[model samples]
Target: MLLQSPTQTVMSLEAPNPLSLHIIHLLMLIKPATSGGRFRVLRTAVSFFYMDPTLMSLRSLQLPSVNTGFGGSADTRTKDLPALQSALLQLTQAGILTDEDSNGNGLNIMPVTCVRAAMLIRCNTLLRGHSGVCLELVQALLLLLRKGMTPIVPLRGSISASGDLIPLSYLAGMLEGNPDIRVRTSTSFVLSADKALELAGSEPITLGPKEDLGLVNGTAPSATLGCLAVHEANKILLLAQGLVAMSCEALLGKAENYHPFISSVCPRPGQVECSATILHFLEGSSLVQSLKEEDKFKPVELNSASDNPIIDIKSGEVYSGANFISSSVANGMEKSRLALQMVGKLLFSLSSELINPTLNRGLPPNVVADDPSLSFTTKLIDISMAAYLSELGYLANPVTPHVQSAEMHNQSINSLALISGRYTLQAADVVAQMCVAHLFAVCQALDLRVIHMTYLKALRTKLVSKVLPFLNGFDDQVAEGIYERLHETIVKSWNASACFDLQERCKIPSKETIPVLRDHLEEHEMHFVSTRPLQRDLENLAYPTFTQTRSEFFVKPPTKQFLGRASLGLYCFVREELGVHFHQGLVEHPGRKTSGKVNGRKKRTIGSWVSIIFTALTNDQVWGHLVEALGSRTCQVRLV
Candidate 1:
């Protein structure tokens, strides 16, 4: 059950779930006196927290300490304690801590959502022998999380060689009621941690012996942040597949590109899943009738016990291990960050293709719905995309290789996992912006391509009809043959204008039986149908240019009609639900050109539309559609 708060009581918490049953079972079987007691308690508390926060008593969780002389300075009872506190310095190093005393009370803060998750791994080492002294810390942390107590701490600090000490200490300081350690409440009220805790309905925790160290003495900070980064990356990974399918439709790319046979020969699990997902999302695509790892990723990172001086309750013994090192997590986060950059590069490539009229197949220049000469649609977007990509590339630089020795060489070759996790999250946001930009361009391109096809059809009919008048007076003998020749000539010219190489190559039998397959196979039956008369008849003929008659054909496109089943849903959601209408040039602008308000609200820009979609992306509203399109609904694909 979820604990609403420490004093909120069990009656107010949510009902028990399966995970809660597991915790209950563990509590029954695992004695608090055994070597596995710490594991049991950690799993119980975390699982219970996940079930639904409930007001569970820490009294039942407290265990008798048999080995208090082994862990952190808490075991020494203030006898020659080492000065390892560096909250101020760590914040200063990150430029977020500016207080002379090093308290970053009023500075920018990162809301660490994964702190609760990290506590699952953090409390593992804490409960070994010092459970009673700091059992309330876990309770206090849960309160902070429920109340949305965001620690006003910088993202830097913590080599993570001996857990995420520097960062976790800030967290610990917040719980211990450090008056200078700041936190922002759920209501955006920034104040001291002690005050925030009071607002959260908890009091400052008093540190005893190793209890303070216990609060920060694990890889909780690094692993917690890593979990957040990895989870978000995984979500984006799925979202990317759906978007790539939309891009393919906009570009009229071949469906065989994502064919299972292609991935079967070179099977990598992640690649296979991605291909399958993209292919599935392309289902029922009218456009696609032509078109189309994470395993053990959690091995040592988020789940590892990063505590120092392990306590064995049953054996009454303590052993030291390098479990506090978080290199594995650090490495994954760095690679994940690098992967985000690669994703941004792909988005750049796709956006460039969509905007370049010459490269975007039959779509108009820049996918501009208005005069291509005047409307620079998506140009600034392209530049912004590049800026985001460059930033992503910079963030993707490996933080592991630049590790500086910390704690006077005691943490030499430290794992900068926290830094890596932070950058990974940053890269994810950059890639997300790239996705937003690409989605906007792709939607515009889709509408333009659909209209372009119709316009071409209408223009060819109109243009070919011009030569009709010349041959109209002729008898049925030559007129039929002459008009047929004119049709073929005009078709070739228009096709060549869109894509030059398609002029000669034979197209398969589509709805039109294509050009080549219309009269059986052109290759097999070579009937030389040339027309010097038809060309001469149209020599001085004046047909409407795309600029002249473009207005008639540029009506709002029925996007769902041409899209595949997956893309159709996305298009409908974007247009209807999100209200991010098609990017229609100047009318979309806010200037006096189209009056102030289109319909009462302020005039919308492309950025406004994109921002709406981006907000939905962050809120996972679009992800819900993606899962529905995939034909199955789970929470999400958890990477770790």
Candidate 2:
């Protein structure tokens, strides 16, 4: 039977549901001091039920008193009962909230991250087995996750010190079925709060005494963003290593800088690990040269940890500390940006070398025919590489020190870790593009060298012997045999154009011919050049050609998607069209191959060679520029 107040009015109703019956049972348990008090409790309970039918399970719940008075004594509540009730009433009423208002906007965080951060807070609280939150609240969180409902939370309003109150209140509002609040579906569509709840088959949950407090107090936002940033940054580092190695091979650079002995002397863990990884990639490569005294290498530095106020689970204590700040992650990203900038700079230098006549050994100026009006020049390639490098220079500025605090006086200091992470991602993307440009230029240079080898026979012999000494003992007949086999493979596999076909060329007639030979003779001539000769020569001579129609020339540019696909060093021009043999055994050194092992190790492949060369190039550029920037180097080595 339910207890009734003297002033209570009865109403006719249909049969009650399981949830409504549970609410009536809870009403019977409460014994208020006066009719007014009983009426207030009844109204509040009914309001909670309407807001969230899931609160029915919380009918037997009891909350820890806020007035437990510091040391958890039971008697102290006598003096603080009224104050506690007042505070709880204020907190519950605050749930009528929304981030979108006439004066300000909502949080800019993605719906997924916002929901994930909230989930992290809940998990942390439950795992500690404290925070005074009820089992029903746990069930409600699990239901939210299972149903894939992402509550809209504010990014700017979180003070973080007062437990991220304003932002988290919006989340709490969603759970209590605040009609004014909105939710985002897993597909990223926004829906009305009630409509979303119905579709998810989830009812809203009422917040018990300290449940609101438990939901907001932690470093979830900072930690989540920081963790994501760290993960992406690590991947960029791996990719950067490959880019560095390719750049090194393109520039004909030495590998001794990454030798273990050099890193072992200094013994910085990050540098040592970086050196080992780079050296492993360079193994068995013919392109990488021995280190000279003039060559310099930079030391590497990397960090993989998060910073402070960690919750100690064993003691169930929240230790107030600096762990919530993410300066370390931001600093690491800043360094990565600098490293990416160095790669961009090196690419610019390599581009210059490929185009300038005097610097590219014996290659033609602009890497085209002597008559520039008839051939494709590398001018556009150089300009595009410069543009990428300039963008990287702008992105390399550190974001760690650019933040200012604004939340009352409580949050007096701030870390721009999130911003730093965003900048790092952008810089990494640009670095990948720059690497593609460098690879294209290198492949073009190699093609030109092979095509004009009749005039460059002495230089070609020297280069081939220096880069691939294992072919030194082969007779002309034997070498020709190898060339024939390689030519067959290239003809079958080649995909890109082998040479530019002359679309009809215009010719001007003399004035005398136009007037006198109008009917008897032709006034002008047009010529068309076929690429068959170059294509035939590429197969017969075991050489590669950079062939395309005038209309097709310079059509492809380095893009993020293109770079992502090309990072493994396999592309139309470099791999299929050129063939591995045209690289003069730089990719697969014949001497390094054994029946089972070479030097007691497995033989490396063409892809491994490309990765190592790019990684070494990237490392040299980053560390070299860093040393120069710090005024530690008296003279920088010029790539030209």
Candidate 3:
């Protein structure tokens, strides 16, 4: 019995459309037992339910006759009941065996029947949600996931798939009054199917013989989960592409790495699309000449019949086939799991390049927040990523290849689609964690790169004015020839050492990088006008311009003009929109809030910022904005 009255039940069942889009017609068939009325018509609209009794009955059908052709009475068809008795049975999902499973679709039927029941203390128990609800829904509920505003339903959304599609058309099926599904020895879940309809002030929800073939007997459960995995994979793929572009900029890569012709030579659709997308993100980037990957998943439709001996009403024929086998979903999920591991491997390589000083170009070792010796900020994450990568690689092994027969071998060659789908979701999660770590390293390295370039620009300006003019005074009449050679040498040498010469380790300058720049100048070979003095002066000027005590440029991050257009947008969004400022190394470790105080907020760690971006991606807050931010930047070719 409902603790709340009918009106309260009605109000609770009315889920507001979050996006404010109209829900057109959702047709429901409700049949009454022990009456001439074959079935009742129930139409659920945007916010209310209305019922209209349709003028149809089982008595009108000519069983074993010429017209309807729903033959019966020849051999006690439909659970030993006469043809008409089977059609009019009140227990909607039973009284006639539709497939191998005589009573239910083998799902935990409580959630399906009790989807909108607004369970009010049945047997001193209430509807139980997953323990992780708070972790998952807190952000959406606090911000975007209003009553009717959700287009993405949580795992529980499958319960309402039959009558409502909420945001996605992925899972589509329904159930009627089935009391047998509610009968169980255990008290877990436990709800009557008719309880929800009782709230609508209508008769019990039950389906007649024709509508009771199968809804849940097929591949919907595993297929729906697979669809969700596919959706998440797309988000991960796109974010990975953006991360690749940002990493390339930080590493000062040649943009030519993702050129169209390189991808076109191979021309696999996935590889081609990925390469083109990276090229688009690296547009206008000076780095692989520059560098640098949404959602469309089509598996089995959840509404399709998955039952054997399907009755075709229009043709009046019963076809027994194996439509219930879920091989498509099984193999699809298996391959998706492997794909996730592959993406994780790519992230592993990129992240290692960012943190390792030798591979990260001029960035500090470990890409630390401050002094390389004192700070090991990214070392933990780097180690964690190795663990994550290993787990992901292990998960990539095929789940379908190890199928086992079940049900006394009557059900041989099992699909194991559900198990495969579950593993795919697990793989997606690992890759997502890997992506987060990589992004953190990329953002830090990008900042250091920008600052490195900015200081070089300032130091170069002082050198050209002071040193170049002084060199021209060496033999004034022939000065132009000498000046041209010296000037060429200065420009080339300055540009070459500009990034490499300014290591964060040599903050005092000249101890490490200056000597290296002197040798690097030997390659430019400006011997016509000596450059050793020129190199020394440039080294001396680098200190006051970037030291902790006396530096004009150290206080401010480098001007944004040094960033490529694609990378600049991503960098600004991370800093400005997410409110995750650059890490100040050891200084940020000790937070502002008192540790024991419950009311005050503690300082967020570097991991916290990465998690924030991870949350945005998981909740789908970034994709729509990303499409707008990166409009048509992808390479396009006319398909033949």
Candidate 4:
């Protein structure tokens, strides 16, 4: 007995099967059309109730000889009934759903990237509502995102002219519950076709007449990858601008190049926008000079758009165009790469000035505060920066020019947008590393200058605030006294002992003295006095520590890990040891509230903090240690 209510109904059949239950549920879910007459109502009802697996085979055998727009030779093949059933059956029998055979050239793409691409395509189609895809197909796509199902899809082999046929077939195959297709579960485990369907609580959807063609007939995958690349490149541009401002500050470069008037003269929108952004970041910065300097600034710009054949629902017209061409995106990424390269060169030049005594105002050669002979890391830093610049140069090559023709004369032209996007990501990561190196050098130079130049105390305070919580109370009088004692001792030893004359004297004698000198000077050589142990007061008084050689100071060579740890140590040392309030920002500014939350606290994006940190780390002496750690291999800056 079947029970029927005003708004709900229970089905009672001879045998209550899953297919019948699904059909009844779907029927209840379908709403009545307001304007479509009997034919429209009938069509809507048929679309909902006809999605039974049992009916699929029988329906395929009885497909009416109807000629649809789909260009297959047989009318049956072009019809929705047989086409959907045949496509599903073909996927179930075949292990892989790629375009090529055994000898065909194809590339395997990441399962996640493929799934994301399919999701984007499905969303676009649904938003337009012109594709003849049934409600069942839409539900399946929604289910895919809700359950986070990722299916393996091929990268290469799609000529992209007949849409993304080869790659999209895998997407269709996964929805059809083909056991051969692999799916990635939310837990990051790879599951067989059946298991994935079961876990998702989704049934295999029966593709309508033109659904399979609709799924495969678009340039969704390439567009998705290109879009993602564009997004990442945009972020890189933001970070790169910040780095440029920091480099300018570290190098004591003039800010007039980034002035509004300079950009107004040329009137290039991209250049004007970049100039404004850089100038905004440099606002209130004492390090940047206001004088009009030579033109040395380059701006970053990015452009992104979708390239897919769109359908008009009102006109019922399918407009096929070469919108899938990604040449514009590829060119934009190349331009971004070039902009990053320019920033790298700026960092390199600033680093050169920081390490060279002649260039860095009056700082020690190589910015080595402790021992010049022991830790000459200037060459190492230069080589690393140069290597990173070289890689950026190589990545800046235009990918649009590399397009090739393939796929049986049908796919006469292609776009390598995905490849270009991947390269752009790699370039951005390398730029981050280069910025980190430049920051370390800048911080070191500032620290050395602060000891002697009182005029730079305010700048030093701002730079130190990022890494250190409070500035350590460095006594100039005490430091000067120590410098005089060390000078007198060195002179006396040179006159009294013959061997002392052969030993090279310390460069730039100041209140700062090497820790080894406090004990006793023996014939121009430092000797530890066994009479008393090293005191904490004496150690704290030493403004900067100096060593004779790399081996004397560092027990082990610095690695990337060592550099990271060392940079972190500087941050910790300032907060814990100095007992000063450490503001991560170079200048004290009010925090701006952001939508993001971290650990239940409202997050804020601090631009000044970013600039301060970049400047401090690049200008800091810690890079000397990183340089020594890298040794001769510093020139090998390969992207991982």
Best by lDDT: 1
lDDT (10s digit) by residue, model 2, range 489-558: 3322221122222111000111111222222112122122333443333233222222221112223222
Which has the higher TM-score value, candidate number 2 or candidate number 3? 3
Order of quality (TM-score): 1, 3, 4, 2
TM-score of each: 0.75, 0.49, 0.64, 0.55
Locate the minimum summed-lDDT window of 10 residues in model 3.
Answer: 123-132
Considering summed lDDT, which 10 consecutive residues are worst modelled in model 1?
A: 47-56
**Candidate 3 residues 35-107, lDDT tens each?**
1111111222211111111212323332221112221222333332224323432212322223322123433
What overall lDDT goes with each candidate model? 0.59, 0.43, 0.47, 0.46
* Best TM-score among the predictions, by candidate number: 1
What is the TM-score (0 to 1) of candidate 1?
A: 0.75
Candidate 1 lDDT over 129-235, as tens digits, reads: 32222345655665565566656665566677777766676677777677777775656566887788788889876554335445666777777677667767877
Residue ranges of candidate 4 with Cα displaced over 4 Å: 1-108, 111-118, 154-160, 290-311, 317-322, 325-331, 356-358, 364-369, 376-381, 444-640
- What is the number of backbone collisions in each predicted candidate, taken in the order shown? 15, 21, 16, 31
lDDT, candidate 4, at 439? 50
Find the number of clashing residue pairs for candidate 2: 21
- Greater lDDT among 1 and 2 belongs to 1
Ten residues in sequence with the least summed lDDT for candidate 2? 32-41
